[model samples]
Target: LIKEYLPGVSILFPYRLLKTEDPLPHSWDVTSDTIAAWVAKQTSALFIKATDVDGIFGEEKVIKNILASDFSEHFDSCIDPALPEFLQKNKMECIIINGKFPERVIQAVYGRPVHCTTVKGNI
Candidate 1:
């Protein structure tokens, strides 16, 4: 559907097989962050990640724009266990926007303000 809608965009999907004895059997051998970092290095393109929420929140559900440097400080409380450490290792400037809003994609691509988690770090 994405290819059909956006004709010129290029997409690459890499898959890995893991043994059950491994810690994360259901997850990819590489983390999403790692893949994102590789993509950025290879293409020099902006990587935007859209999720169900506006962005990561604190215990009180406060919404704040977080820089990559702040991730380690907030990692324990903010990160989703399913996400791999490699993905979060570098501040791969990714935006965690709300996917429910269709226009959010457009806004993100156009560099507009949108609710998201921006990881700031060397890519």
Candidate 2:
């Protein structure tokens, strides 16, 4: 069990019944929606998203920081389509880093600067 390994970590699996028939819930949609709802009721927390690449790319280079308002459908390949809108609407922010390197992930959790993309909705 996860608790056995990381006792301090709390894992939550959230699901909601949709009105649409036979529509499978998209994982990213669930994540974004769940975060939005939880953020409304809790203290602000850093959202770190791990992926294969270093971060979001633009013009063949990583975009260190970007505004949610500047996000477009073209970025759906890198993140969930619903996430940008959710961040902008909620005035939240998230950092994207490469999961391939565990050390970077650790650094991120510790609030240390790392080579990553920061999607800012808090602007």
Candidate 3:
């Protein structure tokens, strides 16, 4: 249904069931893990995470690029604390942009420069 109506947009709801005894996972944790697992099977993958904010910020300014190894665990509000570790483990990269701006997302998809933060995992 999404493909027939959405044209180019693809949205996946990252959800899964677990045992009652198991602890629930955070949405971002599930998403990050899912992306990591998917990337492991593919030859290449580009993770474009669209969120409400422009990108990760430092000192109130947007950080254009940052290594996953350098990402602070304290800032889990913007991204899952597990994301950096997952990215580093998978050697994958994620481009974070504001979903409010569709043009920027399209630009990121086409490998064009845009206002976003790139989390480099190839450490």
Q: Of the candidates shown, which would achieve the greatest TM-score relative to the real structure?
A: 2
**Model 2 stretches astray by more than 4 angstroms:** 1-6, 16-43
User: How are the candidates ranked when ordered by lDDT, highest leading?
Assistant: 3, 2, 1
Q: Model 1, range 73-113, lDDT digits (tens) per residue?
A: 33653344333343446435666677788698779889987
lDDT of 2 by residue, 4-103 (tens): 3376766543333233322334565545534533443244667788889999888988899999888776655466767776777677777889999999
- Which is the better candidate, 1 or 2, if ranked by TM-score? 2
| Candidate topping lDDT | 3
Q: Candidate 1, clashing residue pairs? A: 33-87, 68-120, 96-117
Better of 2 and 3 by lDDT: 3
Q: Please give each candidate's TM-score.
A: 0.59, 0.71, 0.70
Better of 1 and 2 by lDDT: 2
lDDT of 1 at 41: 44
Candidate 3's residue-wise lDDT over 1-123, tens digit each? 112347777654333323332333446555554444344324365678888999888898899999989877566546766777777777778788999999999999999999999988875
Cα lDDT computed for each candidate against the true fold: 0.55, 0.69, 0.71
